[model samples]
Target chain A: MSSTASSTSTQIQLASRPVGWPTPENFRTVTVELPDLAEGEVRVANEFISVDPYMRGRMNDVKSYIPPFALDETMTGGAVGRVIASRAEDLPVGTAVLHQLGWRDIAQAEASAFRQVTEIHGAPLSLHLGILGMTGLTAYVGLTRIAGLRSGETVFISGAAGAVGSAAGQIARLLGAERVIGSAGSAEKVELLTSKYGFDAALNYKDAPVREQLPELALDGVDVFFDNVGGDHLEAALDVMNTGGRLALCGAIASYNAEEPTPGPDNLSALITRSLRMEGFTLGGHFDLADEYAQRMTEWFAAGEIAYDETVVGGIDHAVDAFLGMMQGQNTGKMVVRTA
Target chain B: MSSTASSTSTQIQLASRPVGWPTPENFRTVTVELPDLAEGEVRVANEFISVDPYMRGRMNDVKSYIPPFALDETMTGGAVGRVIASRAEDLPVGTAVLHQLGWRDIAQAEASAFRQVTEIHGAPLSLHLGILGMTGLTAYVGLTRIAGLRSGETVFISGAAGAVGSAAGQIARLLGAERVIGSAGSAEKVELLTSKYGFDAALNYKDAPVREQLPELALDGVDVFFDNVGGDHLEAALDVMNTGGRLALCGAIASYNAEEPTPGPDNLSALITRSLRMEGFTLGGHFDLADEYAQRMTEWFAAGEIAYDETVVGGIDHAVDAFLGMMQGQNTGKMVVRTA
Candidate 1:
């Protein structure tokens, strides 16, 4: 490993802005010698790095909630690692912590910037980047708060097999939803949705048009739609939603990498006729609900009431591959890079 | 005249469902003998009849909040008329009443069906249909309740020269919107938007692309959008919306006549990135707020804080012309047909 013998860190930097769908050429790998830890600073050796769909939006230099990733700089994201060298007493060596200094094998940061996460209770440390982290919290808050999910309401979510969708399906069920339905891209993912994630019905969008297949799955019109995949999925949801339906616009991974502006749903007028409401949200603006989310998700995880899956790509060298693969629907769940 | 010595009422009936933009052939003129009033019924000599954009949706055979007009039957809508004859003791001749029995020179309905309007205090009786009635109520509820309009926020409205839009523009100004911008189809209507309706800036959408013209109009991005015209107008609003912008999806007159499904705004992903919200509403569901809307609008009108306009086409013979003309954007404000 690069960390052996020499005090050096390896990191991936944004080489250039991608014109469309990103490839390996957009990133460059480099090794830099580490400096001695300064007062109040600690050096961390990362264990797992999260790769998410939202990161694709950050690569573009457009104004968004989060600033675009700077060119020639290491990209930042959710990561959990152990402190190897420390000048701060609070973050001592061998302590596991979470920080936003990902895209590198070794992260050096102010101790205050790293949040100590001692134990996730029987789950791997990676849960700090997956189900027990932002991924799980987003699903919980989106359904309960954003969509105003109520007991006995039917909930439909797109991108069911993805990290957020998988968690959302189980969360909806636990929240007393009468029925939970989901859609994924592959037959295996569809099977996994019902067998593992507890989705009452799952659709393989590749087999038929979502609008055609969704109606049968939603015997009565859907009351709430958790929209992770936009485009045709949104159109289908609009078609099948009941009057006064609520849609939580979580993610639009379907058009995240489109080279040009894509066509919107043809049936948005249904929003007016049905008096539906669609509200969009991102995680950063909703950290206030994190504690509640963590408590519930932890209990659910411990009791086996909720299940999570991770698509692990071994090594920091393949982080870009994992990100691209996740974007392409190649990963079944949370796609992460295990740097250690 | 049909209401004179003849004792016959002339009404317009839906002849056939139009394929796209409605034509005169879709309706037929008929004069029928008046039937004797029942125990609780009153005969009204209609004065002013309303022709609204939403009436276009009722012309279709599809189910909606309001049912489709039965084939070969006189279509129903909002109108203000005077009670000419009554079997009920509460309603006397010459009492100005408001009811939903439009599309004719005269009407016969139960006494409970008509709401009596004694006086609008210097405002014309027709104000009950335009500024003091459903049109004005729709604008008030949409901005204050739906969009949650706050002081010092910029407001953008599409179809700003029409009934609800015209009222909405003035209401936004009264609500302490820092700036009010509106879009219209013609230069005349655009001028009236600023000169009469108090819009800070107005765009004649026909002169140039709204997307290109809107950015300069909404300098800091709009906080609230009262969407009366959908399609490209909605797309333009999405392009220039600030974070947490609220969109009140009031109408989609732009697509009301669309022969086929029209593509929605391509930049809907902005809803997620900007944390914007779009909610759809109809007037019927919000009648509980009618008294509040009436009191506020009446006070605003009495104080000259609001202005209203009417585009009148005389005679029941020209009601179809008025309806078609209003749909074609020929009217600048509330399009009403006068039978008296």
Candidate 2:
């Protein structure tokens, strides 16, 4: 290994905006010199980087729940890292922490921006960012608070193989849901949903049109629909929702890259006929509920009542590729970049 | 005064389905002979009748939360009347009550089918079917439970001069909404919204397109949208909703008469960006909260904190004409037909 004096930091920054889908040309990797730590700031050597569909929305310059990222800035997201130098009391050198440090091998941030991982109840450090972090909180608040999901209700989750979707499916089942159906884009995902994740049934959306298949899959009609993929998936879900159905609108990956706005479905009349409730929310907006969610998720993980999976890519140099690929539906579960 | 023995009953049935908009030709008034009351049944001498937009949905044969009216059957709706004669122990002569007795001047109903109004509250019989009945309860449950409306939120009510909309506007104001905006079809109704009902602002939808007018009228953005007209009005609300806005979808009067379903604006993207929540509901499903709503509304009325208006049409002979007129937006506030 190279001496500390010879080691340097590597980073990827937004080079340009894409017209529709982003490409490699839109991003560039650069080597940067490190600066001395400032007061109350700790220097981190990143070990894992997160890539999520929400990042696609941030790349656009339109108004959204979260502000758009500035041009030529380091594309920011959640990461797990180890502190190399510290000037703060809470975080010391060699402590593992999670933060929104973006796609960089090394970062200096206010110690308060980072949450120290203490291996609580013998949990892994990566699980801190996956099941016990933003992703887990999203599924929890959406099902219990937004949807008001009741026991014995049926839940159907679209994009069921993704990070948030997988967590939602299991939690709904554990919460006494009578049936849980899931839709994924691949057969491998379908198998994982039923075999490993405890989903009652899983369908490969690529095998059949969801409009035709969804009704047959959910014969009793869906009481709650956790939607991650909007557009056609929303239209299809609307067609089969029961009277008094509740839809938790979490993400819309399908429209994130559309060149033009998708037209409203002809079936909105169903909203009146069925008396459905559809609500949209962001995990960041629900941060106040984090402590409650962390406690519950911790208990579930400790009891082995819940499990999670992650796809880790090696090295910070490959962070951009992993991110782009995940957005393109290449990853089977949560995609995280591990910097060696 | 004529003796009760000579009183004959008249009923109106749906003669044919309307192609675009219902006309007199779609209904046929018939004279029906009186039937003797059986044990546990009572004869209701119809005193007032209610004509509403929800009846339009029942005319269609499509599946809905409420069963559709069969061809050649008397159109079903809420009606208030005096119990002329009774064979039941609980109900007696001269008691005013409310029931789903359909479009008829006189009807024979089981005592369980009607609720005694005069015994519970010493208010006018018409109040049992309008302000203190389904219309009032709808506004109460929608604002409190469905919309999760907080005090001081700004509200915009569509179809603001109509039955449920009128009630919703006043309730929003009484509940401490800072700004209440309403939209009606006629200029006269707009004036009534602001002057008589205490709405902060009112607009005549026929004067200008709602799409352009909404943003100008609601400069701060709408926090809650009480939607009675769901086509362009819903689209306009989507354009001006504040972050975390809540929409209470009570009815879709704009689409009730469409020959084919109209395509409204595509709004799924807006839902994600604004983090809005839209829920549709009917009053009958929320009957459990009726007692609580009635107590609150009664207190508000007695204290002069809330007020209501009605459009009364005299005589059962003109019931069809009144029903058609109300559906065409000719009536202001709640439309009630006085049969006595």
Q: Highest lDDT: give the candidate number.
A: 1
Per TM-score, the best of the predicted structures is: 1
lDDT of each: 0.91, 0.84
Each model's fraction of native contacts: 0.89, 0.61
lDDT of 1 by residue, A68-145 (tens): 999999989999988888889988888999999979999987899899995856788988887788898899889988
Best by DockQ: 1
Model 1: lDDT of residue A194: 97
Provide the global lDDT of candidate 1 against the true structure: 0.91
What does candidate 1's lDDT look like per residue over B200-312, in tens digits? 99999999999999999888999999999999999999999999999999999989999999999999999999999999999878999998887787778778888778998
User: Per-residue error at A296 for model 2, in Å?
Assistant: 3.7
Put down candidate 2 lDDT per residue, A222-241, tens digits, no spaces. Answer: 99999999877888899999
- Reference-based TM-score of each model: 0.98, 0.92
